[model samples]
Target chain A: MKIEKEPISGQYGKFKIDGIDYRVYWEEAGQGIPLVCLHTAGSDGRQYRALLNDKKILEKFRVIVFDMPWHGKSSPPENAKVGNYKLSTDFYISQIMSFINGLELVKPVVMGCSIGGRIILHLAINFPDKFRALIGLQSAGHLDPYYDISWLHRQDVHGGEVCGGIAYGLMAPTSPESDKFETMWHYMQGGPGIFKGDLFFYKFDGNIGNEIKKIDNSKCPIYLLTGEYDYSATPEETKSLADTIGIEMIKMKNVGHFPMSENPKEFLKYLHPVLNKIS
Target chain B: MFKSLIDDNEKRSQLSIMAQYLNTSFMISTIENEYLVNIEKGVVKNVEEGPFVMPSYVFKLTAPKDEWLKFLKHTPQPGSHDIIAMLRRKVLKFEGDLHPLMSHLLYFKLLLASLRPVENKNEN
Candidate 1:
């Protein structure tokens, strides 16, 4: 019996833009309109590891996954740790654009979770006509009551364990122990102050409350899908956001913030119908 | 270099965004010594020697003097690092009404960690 399966296969490379070198660790398989997958904050594209290998998803989409700068398997920017590594809305959007243009993927349907999900809303408004459609999983107009965990950045604290505890809290209360452990593993490898940096965007810069009205769905349809167990960006929050923006919001049962990773099989139950509508 | 960096007009403006709601004095007592930081509506007016008392202060953060020294270095290790981490491990302590500290957590964190690069500059 093969206990450990072979890792999926894909091309990986590093490219430079505007004098900055970025390591792009990506996987691609099957053929169709490129379905570019973006991960949530402090998490690399491993969130889509299952989808990259899912035969059905591959049959319909060119599934691809890549780590963002300073994230899993990707080298940190030259000055990532110079000071407090804060992320802003413009900077996060720029990174997404770089990924799309750098790979030269044409009209790919962009799907993201958490911070990844929040950015799609901004993408629809700013670039308007770029992506085929934008999907926000566990997304919100903004995340408030942002817990101040800046104290976690110091030298004496256990970075991995503390961050692990925090990450575990956002998952479904009934999540399998193995699933919860795997999720915590991602946060364990997170660079010091990385989660706090991402929250700067998730909590502060990603607030597009009134700006949601400006998203031209005709240019790129905006869809919001959230998990039933996401306390940070609750299903109600996404539902309220969808009602406000006049877009559609779908809730995935038995999942939390990180849908693709938290419960991909169940998430696909909701995902299949949506992808069918888009495709 | 450390002084100039903190007192820089533009960067202070940017960092002040985190502390815009702070309007009180607080002390960061690094064991052997301490620094009393005074602020008004987010702008840091002054930082002076501790054992220096001010009645109108919000709270105080205390850690072993060397702990702060190690932390202010460009890099820190586990056990006594970030304020939250230190607190979790019981190496760092907080006093006075915690409301101010809790309300402006990111502000106080950045304000204190801002001292890290200063230590680096001093070493160079």
Candidate 2:
């Protein structure tokens, strides 16, 4: 299928919270039950610009998309500090909540992709009442013991110094060579300091699996899409997660880490149930 | 501590046995390939010659270009990045044994993982 990017409009601005000023870029589309889509790391909400172009979705709920701090139109804080690094997750969540509260978006169905999913899962665990539903696409939760460590060792030995391991090795498969995506692709590998900082973020010892189990008691239910070939959260892992959380799990056949982007047709099939549950 | 757990002779023999098994069971060739193991052994290994391709029965990964770019942009030299970029573009091809070579390599990798200080009690 031919995919095209659509134009979106939103107020580009900044907000000061916890003594930090963060650039908040947001766009609104459609008009029913509000749905907020958070994009993943390396890229921004523009990734969802095409998804919003759907007339049916436009007719259903108001769709809001935003860029996280340090990605897309959002700017990383000048003179960022070590303390600021620790608050990365907390800051993003609080900013999102503040944004939701500011717009009076009545418990919108919060959807996230990749790190976006990680952010939403954290939100669901810490503040379940704030959201009506959540749809995590290729949502990354915990590191699998089989987590692709070759890449890790490669990055470690390279000292964040080359693209042979990260870009050409890991990112190239998913990245398109078309001119349209080139700018975003370049922006993706723009800084190594940020990439190095992420090494620590992945060091989180907190068990999200345990937090996911907390959803069993939540009034707000979660619908997760586990990619068949996804090493991040394999079907088995999701099954374990579902059983632990006491929720129905949906597995997408023949899909991987970025199912929504990799195999949209199959991903759409898995998504129908989630859409039904939330709607 | 790791040496105490497994006799050094036993470990060496195990490595030799794995190498022999790989040397005999699979064909080592000029074609690039990959292998995956679940036995707490080698998890990832790529043997490529002139180019990179998604091999069958392995965790298929696209060449990591973003990572390559990050390296090239910061490095003082230019030859390495050019070589990797060429490989990613399939200007090169690789040759190796898939399963047996993986088994042999993993024997060493697993030994490393086991010898490391255990961080989590849940680890087997």
Candidate 3:
């Protein structure tokens, strides 16, 4: 028999945020500057599996990834009513702050993708001194609805498979088959209507373009990285956001929305420079 | 060529469990031609070329031949990447009911992807 184990460690921590209790599931590996990763909507911290296993990244930073409530290993608050999950901006901010404060992480670098990407801008505007820096992958200020999200939660639709199918198109065709399917697999396992709920924040409550003007990157440097192939947050949108904010947007070629998960190797090339500057 | 690709056992198997319930037909209208695809329980029953006065399908996907050419490429560009993307970008238009298409989205997505040439299937 042959077996191997990963260096990553997992645990659950209890926290109270905004009058609600959450048992958040988190995984971590490596040691150095604290790097808190935020996964995309309809997915969880497992998206950072490659980053958690990278030896060089581990040597330079303590990478931590947590599934947001109602995602991955994290369960929705027991006190909450069924089918009432909605991720409001205030609620989302409270959750992240609660988790960070609970763990007593000092000035951790927060890196987020997709909806995670959008929230980091909010974080920067709301709490400039809370982090050392912010990295937004496939981030944008606002996006018009491309399709009717009503299809996502209907009784007739298989929520997980349809979500996965939608996500499949968001990845660059150049990404490896194994990685592309693995990324889609995460969406396929999401709880019903959870993806749509998160989109509420992404598409509606989280439109922070006006509020983001208050972000003084001098206090917390903001790095915007977008993939050319991400239709949800197209490179053009990111570029427009960057232009609005007077910052540069790094356009990653042959990559897409789920950069860290779909093509980690290529993503790292674009990320190393940002990490180095932050360090 | 499209029918043979969809009917291939290996490709049909890749549709997996999603195909079990997808008993529907759809029409694909390119600039120059139209084809009606019929599927039942995950297998392609037939794909018929058309010049008919009236044809029946749950939904119809219409696009220019140039757009289809780009979409069918081994590695499609950003806006042309997927059926959803094409629809979002307005490069592809859909008419008729979308319930069957959206409900069994993965099956349809994989079915269309199977039309790509085998030689470039593995290309990155």
Number of the top candidate by lDDT? Answer: 3
Would you estimate the TM-scores of all the predictions?
0.67, 0.59, 0.95
Which should have the higher DockQ, number 1 or number 2? Answer: 2
For the predicted complex of model 1, DockQ is: 0.02
Residue B51 lDDT (model 1):
58
- Each model's lDDT comes to 0.73, 0.51, 0.88
- Indicate the residue-level lDDT of B72 in model 2: 28
The CA lDDT at A190 in model 2 is 33
Report the lDDT tens digits of candidate 3 across residue range B1-124.
3546456567767675677866888889886788888888877888988776888899999998888877877878888878888988887987889988888787787778777665666544
What's the distance in Å from true for residue A13, model 1? 2.3
lDDT tens string, model 1, B15-87? 7775566688777776767666778878888777645554456788888877676666664543333565566
Two-chain DockQ for each candidate model: 0.02, 0.03, 0.75
Q: Model 2, A1-279: lDDT tens per residue?
A: 798556357768777656677777888787888889876544566657645665656667788987766656667777864323332666667777877876788989898765666676777788888778987665555653322223322223332223122322222222232422332353344333443333334325323755676664367778777665444444665666667767767776655455545445556667655666677
Query: How would you encode candidate 3's per-residue C-alpha lDDT over A47-116 as one tens digit per residue?
Result: 9999999887898899999999999999889877656888999998898889888889999999999998
Better of 1 and 3 by lDDT: 3
The residue ranges of model 1 lying beyond 4 angstroms of the native Cα positions read A1-7, A17-19, A79-83, B1-124
Q: What is the TM-score of chain A alone in each candidate?
A: 0.93, 0.77, 0.98
